[model samples]
Target chain A: MPSEFTSTLNSSTLEAGQTQLKIDGLQLNFGGVAALYNISLEVKQSEILAIIGPNGAGKTSLLNCISGLYHPQRGKITYFNSSEHEMTHMKPHQIAQLGVARSFQNIELFRHMTVLDNLLSGCHIHMKTDLFSSMLYWGKAQREHIQFRRFVEDIIDLLEIEAIRYQTVGSLSYGLQKRVEMGRALAMRPSLLLLDEPMAGMNSEEKEDMARFVLDINEEHGVTIVLIEHDMGVVMDISDRIAVLNFGQKIGEGTPDEVRRNPVVIEAYLGEEHSPYPLRSKL
Target chain B: MISGIFHSTYEQDMALRHTHAQKIRLAILIVFLLVFPFLANRYYLTLANQIGIAVIGAIGLNILVGYTGQISLGQGGFMAVGAYTAGILTARMGMPWWASTLVACFVTAGVGAAFGLPSLRLKGLYLAIATLAAQEIILWVVTHWKAVTGGVDALVVPNPELFGIRMNTDFNFYWLVWALVILVTFASVNLFRTRFGRAFIAIRDQDIAASVMGVDLFKYKLLAFAISSFWVGLAGALTAHYRSIVTWERFTIDVSVLYLAMIIIGGLGKITGSYLGAIFMTLLPAVLSNLGRVVKGVFPGVEGIIPFIQQATFGLVIILFLILEPEGLNKIWKNIKDYFRLWPFSY
Candidate 1:
């Protein structure tokens, strides 16, 4: 059973197999160089979907487009929760306010802030105290602050980061910083969470921990997760669905078993003899 | 090294002062501040007033430069706006000092926000250059617009009267200024405990991530400018009344650099650092001149060198502080406290 803190994170949950995010015929370019082209994808509610691709394959670009960090020149991205939110033209912060939270590929944390404060920052949209009230921090401001502090504590507890909660994020280990980044995203209470290269630098043990947290957040908390990962073993073991990209184009996408058997995915990515990923049979 | 703090409630845990010792020490400090003017003479009272005003201004700049990581060199211009607004309101219209000061803060805040608009596109050195333009433009307006500002003639400010009591003396102004300092300190310290404070620091560290986390870059950046300028404006208003005059010469670019030096040498992003830096920067010249008197007594041929020595010392000390400890005196003080805190239990 989920704790009270964990259960209250998402205000609403979608039924399984419902379309949480729909991206149709999206195209992005940088001064004539295409970063992504003709990409169409759908993320189901309460499922772990992993995007696997080589470097420069536009995996991170797609996540950025969805989070409103990058503007795709063409097509539309729709996020459906309580209602449909046309996310293409909205500013990054406006998208975040509509319950879309993302962790960066390079661990974009408030490095000088304490881990607890970094997580509280993720609760920015939820916090409602005005500037004048914040200056006099007593009454409603103090009440709101303490209430959110309690909310962030649950994320800290779930991520098993209570030991370093008061330490600066910059001073933490790389693996720990990645965990804190996830904790920060979790603090946002997002119904749709996007993760870019979440396990890029983590060791096997840390990757297992992160994978478990992702699955738990998806299954227990009912958050729809779309992640980009390179490790085939972890992706094949954990993800409910997988999407493959090559040279800024989607080549194949399916359940792990189907993607593993797809001739195109095998030819373009998986068939490389000196691949970084362990053999599929090893998984 | 100090332990044994247990909070039974979240409010207790979130308190600015965590321990009974902290509360008791704060009480003693407050009592001492109230009684300081009584113990000191006029010279010390004057110095106290200067430090008090500097504290407010330095804390304001720290909010912009130190906490928000937006470098602004137009502090002098913002202060000028505050002084002139207060000066014009009081001397020309017969407005109350309190109301004028309040109006001055708002006017300066508006001006500061207008200048901060450039920050939405510029950063680092480019932003610094843009804010320097703000300083130049405001100074030019004050200098060229002779009709309103009195240009070269300057504006004479009358002493403020509160409850029929004239606040013309250094002793009276010391209490008034220090009271505001205390209030500003509490407000800034409290500001950091909330989401606004967190968002400012987050923007400083990583702006893109802050935006993705739902912090509006433009709004928070401008809000920082407005709030920071408000306090600086308050300091300028107090300075006008305390000096009984307002002049464009007083709000020069050098004054802006001095405030920046205060925050840098005291400690960036720290409230206590602002206090320490203000006291240190304000007293450096006085202390240097006192030392100069002894030097002149020994050799009466070095009077011209003494003024140059004071300026050189300021630059030298700032460079030395940066090289030795960029965290400023706050970190050094913490190191000392930690050493004593764990004394005789060396591990």
Candidate 2:
């Protein structure tokens, strides 16, 4: 496993992970209530896979299960970086070490750490493991850090957060904090990135900026991203494929056009009584 | 004229010192530290030595509680391990101060890691309680163990000799204590510039988020414990040699509270704050005691009231500081420096 991971890591450009993220028969529970039940979907590699659902539709829960945050009682989540790997049973850090990075629904930026420091933390797996490196940081640690900092600086430039790069994350406005959050996840240089409502509590301008960043990260970096979002219009615009969930079960899964026209998907978004036309028009 | 540093590269941008003014200020500070021993009397030198020991131990505690966000009141316990180990090695087995201190550091770190093992299973107030339990256990062991520690009796430490030069005098010891203080401070300041320090901060902020970012929560938490204990242990070994004795009572729960107070009053997470907080806290008691003596002499009928007044003053100072500047002395220092940098236009 280590050799295979190293082989994939040594390559300068990402030239792999071109298989589907197959989530089959995923079941999670909190006490007795089911969070997700019998959920299955496939996210094609290098595509923006957006999971859309109502408030309690288990969108974030599915992402949690996929990213190995929540261990489900039943089901398997499989991904391919260069070869098939089981992620459902892995620890969150182990999954992340395999180049799967994620951001939280609520901003989880290290509030005390500076923006630069938070992003530096995103490269945790890439750094040397010895505590001595940090104790005497002028040698190997400093060299490796300056190298990663250059990469983080590029990300800062890309996210348009350079002016506030040295500021504490807690001091930033909500919109700016969200941008930094995305930048931190991107700093991992992950082959697969997961975002949970990247644009939550954002103004129109902030939402547009976040959307563009998502698009750029996908197109330019060629990173396979799975995002959980509520904004139907934004989800419809960027998603190469859409998976809709309702009450712990997947109701519909397809491309934007296919999911948009599907009766089940429309019904899930609206109600059984309401017509799907108004929702489609809103999108 | 150059108004500020113009960083030409990313490394320069992240360098610890960005300006000539900072370099100049640091230089002056270094000179002052070097010259301090000659200027001060023996009493003041001993007080300075106390501050030096407190500074190192406080930095260690700061790393665990401040940077890693793990609350630990077992600092004195770890320090006891170091002090006892150093005492046994140097006084009993006839080892050198440097070698014994180094060995004591590793021993204390191991004990500290053992206690920190439960940190992964506990957090916040629970973790604090667990470490508090560790402190109690360590203290119990140190008190009961007789032959090695001399039990309740003092285990005398011979004067540390570097190249056969005796360091019993406060003037000589001053150089050694302050020098270790400098090295520890330097290493700690550099710690945050690298990934390990950043990861610790991340774990402190949000463990789940840090895990998703690829930081091993278990490893970093334990590492935080070990690293912090190493510093406290080193301080312990130094104190053993400096005081020329090791006793179990010297490392009681009160010492742990004092160390925590140093970190809190200095600043929770900042290195400079820890140093300043140590200085401020270590001297505050002495200053209060002197003030109390003056009050007692003036009032004539307040023999029992002086200690109470000292206690009240300590609590009052902490409360006032927490209310006015909760960020600690580091924030105050930063504000002062910023104001000076902005000059006449300062807001």
Candidate 3:
């Protein structure tokens, strides 16, 4: 079923194993409190780089800075698509136009619109018909609208959301809404996809489905992904590399196996298992 | 299940009128509109003209408030801009009616976009107040800018010459006005079907998500305002030409509230609501006055308070619609259609 969808994915313009995004000494503060402190990270092309951290570790904040939702007080975030694009100060829409798309931690599908319309909106930047042409609803406007509708239908098929394509997004279940959000992001034809806890609240079966979709998006779509996840099992299973943040700093960064073995990573999680305040006793 | 509706192609699926029944109904409507002038008397013709003008204005307001979810109290002010612009161009500067109306639309759209600047940082009730301020400011300019607006006295608008024929009678203006009403309605429907319309709705639904999904929030918000005001400005220009006068009193804060009531009662976010709302609101006063005349004939002493009763009834009806049917006339119309759609077999 998924083999046919290979044609739907844009042929990757990027060379394999190239640096896709580089974040340098990122500093973000809300008033006097620092959210992200000197976070430097690298995302290679078509890799699933999961950022795992405890609460308030600035994992989501890092993703937000890279996606242009938050401007870091000091740091440079550069995206490498066809060229090196300085994305530190770009607007969200401008960054999106350059093939960067993000799904919110909470599903942000247009509540009033149908599933299809929300996905169709993902094709907004690609569409070129002006107001007058749209008003006439013929020639360019009709062609573009139908073409994008076809594109959105392909995404709907890939996500296996055909049944709820016409359903209002607000009426959908949590898992379905999350899938729809991913489908909407995919509809943008993004080269870099930022997902904040894509499987935050879901059953094991739903979590497995989401993990599979995330892998499919990264591998099959040839898109670089920066994911923030709390589930250690899924993170270890699917992530190509893992970056761990604790207390607004990157505590450990390596391959999933390496990170799992690192004492620092284990301490951040289990917290000095044999020591006096072994994280469990503190909690 | 909806039976006998099938589409083999995307074009068919994306068509404005989907089913054969809808197309048939559209044909029937076109026939009715074409035959209306001949059947109706002069008084009804004038009334129809008024409804047509209101329909144009209400649809414009609905685009901003209903579809785009931007509450605006500047509809009346924008209309005044259109009316005054057209009045000055045609009556003061000797420009042709059509040309002046065209300029009026663009001018009003510019003003609307300018006022919409505050919307980028504002939301909901705060944004509504900002637009209300726009209404008051534009009205003040129109009233105090005496040399251009012709002081406190009403500016006289020339009867427009359409295709070399003087459009002085309600019979002549009715066709022109209704034709525009149809054109603007078609345009509004088309606007929503495309990406531009989707952008407007996206901003309304979720601004942050929309921006991240590549919708330029500031550009689209201003565009919504400009497009909305263009339709409204056209309505105002037509009103000026139809009535052969332009006055500050006609485009007051109360008039802005009245337009808001039209969209609220018509159903927000639906084009059908705009048409139904405009017709219902325009006809409401006329119906109440006729009822007033009948009551006066019966009592002979109730004439003095009839105006007050009319005002009170209009306010009460708006409140009733808000509380009882917030979705407006469009929902009721849909309910009627749905009930009959499945007939006796319906659950």
Give me the candidate number with maximum DockQ.
Answer: 1
Model no. 2, DockQ: 0.76
Tens digit of lDDT per residue, candidate 3, span B1-347?
46656778989877878866678989999999999999999989989999999999999999999988889999999999999999889998999999999999999999999999998999899999999999999999998999899766899988899778988588888888998999999999999988888888998898899999999899999999999999999999998988889999999999899999999999998899998999999999999999999999899999999999999999999999999999999999999877877777776
Between prediction 1 and prediction 2, which has the larger lDDT?
A: 1
In the predicted model 1, the residue pairs found to clash are: none
lDDT by residue (tens digit), candidate 2, B1-347: 24655788877888889887799999999999988898999989999999999999999999999999999988888899999999999999999989999999999999999999999989999998999999999988888888677788889899898887888579898899898999998888888777778888888899899999888889889888898999999999999999888999899998888899889999998899888999999899899888878888888988788888888889898899889999999999999988888687745
Q: Rank by TM-score, descending?
A: 1, 3, 2
Q: What TM-score describes the B chain of model 1?
A: 0.97
Q: How large is the interface RMSD of each prediction? A: 0.7, 1.1, 0.7
The residue ranges of model 3 lying beyond 4 angstroms of the native Cα positions read A1-12, A270-283
Q: Where is model 1 more than 4 Å wrong at Cα?
A: A1-6, A272-283, B1-4
Off by over 4 Å in 2: A1-17, A271-283, B1-5
List, for all models, the DockQ compared with the true complex. 0.85, 0.76, 0.84
Put down candidate 3 lDDT per residue, A173-209, tens digits, no spaces: 9999999998888888888888999999999999999
- Which is the leading candidate under lDDT? 1
